[model samples]
Target: MPESATLPSATTKLEYLRKDLEDLRYYLDEFSAFLPL
Candidate 1:
């Protein structure tokens, strides 16, 4: 309900999302290099 209380959870969620996106990009890059486009 309070903005202060919700900030940490939002930050943690963003961090997780960022890490997942980074991992996906890394794998995609590796896969793309082996495939012709």
Candidate 2:
């Protein structure tokens, strides 16, 4: 298999996952701030 045929898709998938994780972390941070210690 040639990387020219597969690299872009793999890179895009990773980028999408990273964005999702960032959003999830942001939401968790906000939610945790509202909780009492």
Candidate 3:
């Protein structure tokens, strides 16, 4: 099997996942701010 077929695509997917997680955290924080403790 070729190495290029496996590695580069996974890195791209990881980067996308990280961005999505960051956005989710940001929204969660915003929602938390509106709630009474």
Candidate 4:
């Protein structure tokens, strides 16, 4: 495979992973606030 193709695939995967992580963090924060004391 060409390096150009591989580079974009890697970048897209990284972008998706970062978005997933951010979403997870937001969910966790909301859950924490909802927990009882």
Candidate 5:
């Protein structure tokens, strides 16, 4: 169970998650200008 973070599946999943986060951030920034805050 140790060092399981190096698994190929986990790495790919992490990449996908990171990409999604970046996309979300970009969209948020794009729309934030129209927000009341």
Candidate 6:
């Protein structure tokens, strides 16, 4: 019962982290287009 109480917040944190990573990747991809290999 105690573990169930903590699960929602932990899942929300994980979702936020995943969204941050996706946003970071998008910005990096955009920046990389202007750089020459």
Weakest ten-residue segment in model 5 by summed lDDT: 1-10
| Per-residue alpha-carbon lDDT of candidate 2 for residues 1-37, written as tens digits (9 for 90 to 100) | 7988899999999999999999999999999999985
Worst 10 residues of 6 by lDDT: 28-37
Give the Cα-based TM-score of candidate 2 against the true structure. 0.80
TM-score for candidate 6: 0.90
- Candidate 4 residue-wise lDDT, 1-37, digit = tens: 6998799999999999999999999999999998985
Off by over 4 Å in 4: none
Instruction: Score residue 5 of candidate 5 by CA lDDT.
Output: 56
Better of 2 and 5 by lDDT: 2
Looking at model 3, residue 27 earns an lDDT score of 99
RMSD of each: 1.4, 1.4, 1.4, 1.8, 3.2, 0.7
Q: 1 or 6, which is superior by lDDT?
A: 1
Q: Model 1 over residues 1-37: C-alpha lDDT tens digits?
A: 6999999999999999999999999999999999998
User: What is the Å distance of residue 8 in model 3 from its true position?
Assistant: 1.3
Lowest summed-lDDT stretch of 10 residues in model 2? 28-37
Candidate 2 wrongly placed segments (more than 4 Å): none
Worst 10 residues of 1 by lDDT: 1-10
Residue 10 in candidate 3, Cα distance off native in Å: 0.3
* Alpha-carbon local distance difference test for all models: 0.98, 0.95, 0.94, 0.95, 0.92, 0.97
lDDT of 6 by residue, 1-37 (tens): 9899999999999999999999999999999999896
Give the clashing residue pairs of candidate 2, or none: none
lDDT of 5 by residue, 1-36 (tens): 656756878899999999999999999999999998
Q: List the residue pairs that clash in candidate 6.
A: none
| Per-model tally of clashing residue pairs | 0, 0, 0, 0, 0, 0
